[model samples]
Target: MTPPAITGQVALVEDDYTLVINRGTEAGVVAGMVFAVSSGTGQVITDPESGRELGRLSREKLRVRVFDVQPLFARAHTFAETDSFYGLLRIPFVATDDVVTIDVGDPVEAIAIEGMGYRKEANGY
Candidate 1:
């Protein structure tokens, strides 16, 4: 049988910084795990020839690491990729003309369980 799907949504945002996801220990979530939040306005991709809906392509808003977890939820935050030399904060990578922040109810997906590959290709394999 197939395992249950592990998916969640952004439940809250604290002061426009901290984000809360709806999955937690009950869903196999642990601290230091990364979750990706995608924008809701995803463009639907379709097959040109058959005119069949293939999938939705959405821009990932940002990735957050969970620092706090409870039975039913988790809190997370993200830090900008800083300049090592001068410690300057860089602009958001996915910056759009209008929005660059995580909004409540955005879809969140776990970034765990990278699949099989040539072992030599991975570092320290």
Candidate 2:
């Protein structure tokens, strides 16, 4: 996994709502890694001058805490925080008009780096 990454993804969600994320032993995934689940459309940015792609703007869906780990993946579940409402992140000047849901392709990003401590700002990523 890239050091710049809070690397992970939602691999499976149990009927009981347990989340299986795609990061494990080899990927340096361990118990207690906090993951932020996001499900929203991202806008691709391109350089207006040269038409080069810059980056994508994404939205945070929710947060999950890992309680177990294995060789291929890890299991996670949700918790509450003041700013996170199920998955709705508060963004200034941006209006979210659609409903979001937990799904197969939704990204599950780790909230902390290995040593850099926790990053609470979603836009910093």
Candidate 3:
């Protein structure tokens, strides 16, 4: 099935990892829904020569798992990444792991159902 349309923005990113989204049950958001966060309109790509439009650059920032759905707001937490990055270091080729945090005011869109790929391994492997 297709993912839900992006109809919300992150209202806040709590210290405890809980995120408050502007959309909730009224916007077809339900508990256990997973949302993906990105840079939103904050970044854009443009041709340097023409100074013309190219496209908005949005990279997957973080994933959130919704738990409490209110009328105008829902609570969630940074869960996992829809995409992971791995880097090789030097001759030894050490692996590098990167974790993206959902910053406040970032655009959030429903992307998957909860438990779809929930990881039980520690450190969210």
Candidate 4:
């Protein structure tokens, strides 16, 4: 049987920085999943203590998933440089499944799962 359909939004994005994924049992991120990386151009103006947003400067869909997450922790490059980076985790085979992108301040979920093929290729086995 196929895996259940899953959907999520981009929860986090580290622009111009490398996202270090732990392939160990800690992080639950699996292979064959797609993530969306986005950015906001507008200024997020807000009160000092109240934390109330005064207004939005601008918003834009910077870039889509350019990197298909490999099974191991390697240096994955970014498509473009921006202020924010969001990771939307979703199973690709599941068409109906909703995808949730990760944004700033979101909890990190899932460890990177190293596929056998990827390991062999990387090690030249």
Q: Which stretches of candidate 4 lie over 4 Å from their true place?
A: 1-25, 40-42, 45-51, 54-125
Task: Report the C-alpha displacement of residue 73, candidate 3, in angstroms.
Answer: 0.5
TM-score of 4: 0.25
The digit string of per-residue lDDT tens for model 4 on 1-125 reads 42332222343345433333323112333543222333334578998989999876533322232233444432222232223232233221221354433344322222112222212111133
Candidate 3 wrong stretches, greater than 4 Å: 1-4, 41-43, 47-51, 81-101, 115-125
Candidate 1's clash total is 0
TM-score of 3: 0.66
lDDT of 4: 0.33
Model 1, range 29-76, lDDT digits (tens) per residue? 778666778887789999999999999887888767677999999998
Error of 4 at 105 (Å): 13
Please give the lDDT score at residue 64 for candidate 3: 69
The most accurate candidate by TM-score is: 1
Candidate 1 lDDT (Cα, whole model)? Answer: 0.70
Per-model TM-score versus the true fold: 0.69, 0.65, 0.66, 0.25
How many residue pairs clash in model 2?
Answer: 2
What's the C-alpha lDDT at position 110 in model 2?
Answer: 78
Q: In candidate 1, what residue range of length 10 has the lowest lDDT sum?
A: 114-123
Angstrom error of the Cα, residue 75, model 1: value is: 0.4
TM-score comparison, 1 vs 3, better candidate: 1
82-111: candidate 2 lDDT, tens digit per residue? 345643452212125743467876887777
